[model samples]
Target: MPLATSLAIFQSCKIIGVPKSTRCAILRDMAKVRKAERRPPLNKTHKLKRQDWAKKYLKTDFSKVLWTDEMRVSLDGPDGWARGWIGKGQGAPVRLRRQQDGGGVLVWAGIIKDELVGPFQVEDGVELNSQSYCQFLEDTFFKQWYRKKSASFQKNMIFMQDNAPTHASKYSTAWLARKGIKEEKLMTWPPCSPDLNPIENLWSIIKCEIYKEGKQYTSLNSVWEAVVANVGFKKLVETLDKRYDFPSRNHFSRVCLPALYDECRQGVLKDLANVKYFATTTDLWSSQTMEPNMSLTVHFIDADFNMETRCLQTSYFPEDHTGQNIAAGLRQAIAAWNLDEGKLICMTTDNARNVTLAAQLNGWMRLQCFGHRLHLAIGKLDMIYGCNY
Candidate 1:
């Protein structure tokens, strides 16, 4: 019989003021009562098998492979529990609210071998779907690691990533295959296991450096600046493998030594071509003075050759309505650099009527800004009458 039912019967019988010897007889009988069904024994063996496998996997080449993953950093306070003491009698202490001075921005980034790829802006409401994943893989990740001449340093290397839905999708898998990335080359770490990746250690180091400078940030720009300035590639690499120390007398000494040796081998070979020069892109914004302003920046590379970026000259609508004024700034910059108009490549800009007309007149190729294209796509979706594509 269940313990609760037996205890209830005992209590009811006691209320009747039964004799002590009779009550003792009932209690003794209740002690021998048992349930009709039996349960399976606890599976200690299965747990032990899993642990053994984990230990073996940790000692293999899987651990030597560099793992990469993305994390989002918010300008707002962290999610989940607040740390502090609670009084003995207090009815669930109130969470201390942290005041945030500025709004937040979404940062999308991937890391491998103590190297970070980006903290690219993923504007609010933009979903991180397969398409975005592909874009990031092609436009940012592969571009930064393989396309540039400087990144020639990464030849014949393997990259390890998680089995995220997008990463495992058919399209992404095919893309990787086309790019000469091998599935077998990728090290498969156990699912739901983050403790093994050293990048997590790097993140802690990044946060420490950010706070060490004693700077307070209130805006998204300030937060981005602080994060960028603090977490460079060198600092991330310095913290890797710092937690492990193997004794020479250990049975597993040789097994662990190979992983450490591999790291040293890669560290000694540096790519002197400088990858930083090709990873930047240019952006041009309008000024309040009704005059166009242009800034040159690097974006990405292709086939180890740096792909130059060109921003369209901003067009201003004045009472004069003359093309000469708009073209003057661009012409001056080109002449100063001694560049010929025939050598000009792709031009990216907003779909201003004047700018389109100007590009057509100059015989230069123009691509509408991708941000503008996304905005237009969203607008079109809202106006889809019925089955229009």
Candidate 2:
């Protein structure tokens, strides 16, 4: 939440060492104030459910929880984004971007691997009831999709679904029970949170890949074909493998991250501009695909004699990572930072032949990076101790 205005904050509070304009600019630029519109608020029970969903199940594998969601596949257009600047209570003209009963197809699907489960389409003009949903599970799911699984496979699996009226109804529960699915076995889902559901993103990815191949869709069959062919399921899984969560892009993307990055970068540069001398280190590596890359960093002692380090660049190495090419990239990055060579100390990199040659070519005093040397020393020690053991 933001205060009414910067002036109000300044007037009501003590003026510390911070500047008025700086604080006001931060509020206006970084602090986005969204009006809490009328929406269903979560109760304590829902909060606890969300908390439970967050906790790791030690005895259970994640594959047991079959994440699923529903999506509307529309041919009319990709959902468009709208943004604006406005004052309080000021009205603006708007036009309806979506049609109620035309030009969209409702589909349900699940994803746990590169393979997609059935993208079953809900019939037109048919409001899905508990019986129909259960029928879908028995027919499309059991017969067409998952019936091929081994008994052990199905035995280990636990179904997850949103707490829609149909999902929780007697008909649905009875169907699940007949299939030996326990009621308490279902994974808890927090309401009003699409971010928690990764299957939703899988749908978007398929859609985007479909359109990227061809903008015009003659039939919904072509759309499904694109979904089946082009979507990179493994890549999407690999992306989310390490990270827990990202902040809402709509909030942070517009200004917050970029602004913070720029501020820190400028601060580093300002410090470097004053430092009399500094050293740089380089590292080079290749991807699994054999694409070469280089990473460079600068280190220095600031005015207070505090050891400071900052990564200058990490990007593709040109053509090949030969001595000449590496030197070209190294010089370019250093020049971009406007680092002076006159008062420079030395350049540090692993004792790679090409890298050392590149340093010598540039007339730079080359030193072995202490970090790389220590890493090599540790590797040698491990090898020696392992043989004895």
Report the number of clashing residue pairs per model: 4, 0
Q: Which candidate comes out best when scored by lDDT?
A: 2
Segments of candidate 2 deviating more than 4 angstroms: 1-40, 54-59, 81-98, 113-115, 210-219, 231-389
- Tens digit per residue, CA lDDT, model 1, 1-389: 35444446667656656666676687786475554564333267745654764775554543335456665554543443133456788766444344542345555565545345565556555667777777767776677645662434444355666667877678877777777666555554444445556667656655555544233445566566556555443355445434423233243347666677566535422231233322212234556555645553323343467564433223343323234443454455444433445555656666766656655666667777899888888778878854344
Q: CA lDDT, every prediction? A: 0.53, 0.71
The digit string of per-residue lDDT tens for model 2 on 158-266 reads 7778878788787888788888776556665677556677787787776665555225444555454444445363356446453423234455667777798789889
Q: 53, model 2: CA deviation in Å?
A: 4.0
Locate the minimum summed-lDDT window of 10 residues in model 1: 272-281
Tell me which residue pairs clash in candidate 1.
280-298, 280-299, 281-298, 281-299
Worst 10 residues of 2 by lDDT: 240-249
